[model samples]
Target: MSKYDIALERIDAAHKDDPTTITINTTTLPYELHYAQQMTLYLERLDPNASELLRLAIRAQHLRRWEIPRSSYPATKIGYHSWRGALQREQAALVEKICVESGYTEAEAARIGALVRKADLRKGDPDTQTLEDVACLVFLDDQFDKFEKDLGDEDKIVDILRKTWGKMSEAGRSEALKIKLSERGECVGTEGFGWLSVK
Candidate 1:
């Protein structure tokens, strides 16, 4: 197999350890593995010609995420941000190791690590933007309905969706509009928030 294939295999191996399993279309999959697959699918839709490094970064987006649960930190917003930052750092390091093991040069591996951490996200790098867009698309397409139902707070759901929407590029937002959200999801950002009319 190629180096890319080897690296991808290693990433999926790590994801396979996730204890959290979710059933989708009658197939049970480790949650992070499923999430990674969704990220790749959306990346293909958003940028079919995505580079090797970006593809590897996307595949390892949530590498071994269950190792650090949200409950490990406080329930405050600061805690959430802290936990997310930690996850990004950890995932980046882990994927960098995998890239090197799969025969990538140190520089290439480090580049993939930066992509995983979204280090240039604020700089408007096209690859980083595509990664962010894929992440948002996955959340909306694969997780939003269940998340909305579980939260059971329309206001909170809208707030969360608004924040998620704010992170996407115009292409991402356009793709999000095509997702078939649940009835409740369809109502979000449409009542009065003219800035985010997903419907």
Candidate 2:
């Protein structure tokens, strides 16, 4: 098989071993595996011309996330940021190792790792922006309603939407507006993020 295929196979194998499972559309899948699949789908929709490295990075964005539970860090915002930073580094390292083992060069592996690590986000790097867009789109498409319900606070939900909206590019925001949120989610979303007008 090709290096890219081999790397994806290894990543899928690891995700398949996740002890947790979720049912989607009458099929049960490992949670991380399902999440990875969603990320890839969103990335494809966001940028069909994305580089192979970006594709691989998106697929492995949350590699073995359950291994690092959020409870491991403090419950403060600072702790949340710290936990995310650490996860990015850990996921990048794991993906790089897989890339190298699949016959990719160190430089190629490093590029993939950098994408997974979200390097140069504030600098407006195209690949990083694409990744961020995909992430936000995935959240909006699949997780927004559940997230809003779980939070149960309009202000907090709006705050979250504002932050998510800020991270998205225009293309991403356009796609997000197409998502069909629940009635309440749509109402809160429209109120919280003025850019969206849900019908």
Which candidate has the highest lDDT of all? 1
Please, what are the lDDT tens digits per residue for candidate 2 over residues 1-199? 9999999999988899889999978999998899899999988788898888899999998898888889999999999999999998999999999999999999999999998889988998999999999989889888888898998989888988999998998888888888888888888877777767743
lDDT of 1 by residue, 1-199 (tens): 9999999999999999999999979999999999999999999899999999999999999999999899999999999999999999999999999999999999999999999999999998989999999999999889988898999887888788878889999999989888887766677657624444635
- TM-score winner among the candidates? 2
Scored by CA lDDT, what does every candidate get? 0.90, 0.89
Q: Which residue pairs collide, candidate 1?
A: none
Candidate 2, residue 2: the lDDT equals: 93
Q: Each model's TM-score, in the order given?
A: 0.95, 0.96
Q: After superposition, how far is residue 155 of candidate 2 from its true place, in Å?
A: 0.6
Worst 10 residues of 1 by lDDT: 189-198
Candidate 1: where are CA atoms >4 Å away?
192-199
Residue 8 C-alpha lDDT in model 2: 95
**Residue ranges of candidate 2 with Cα displaced over 4 Å:** none
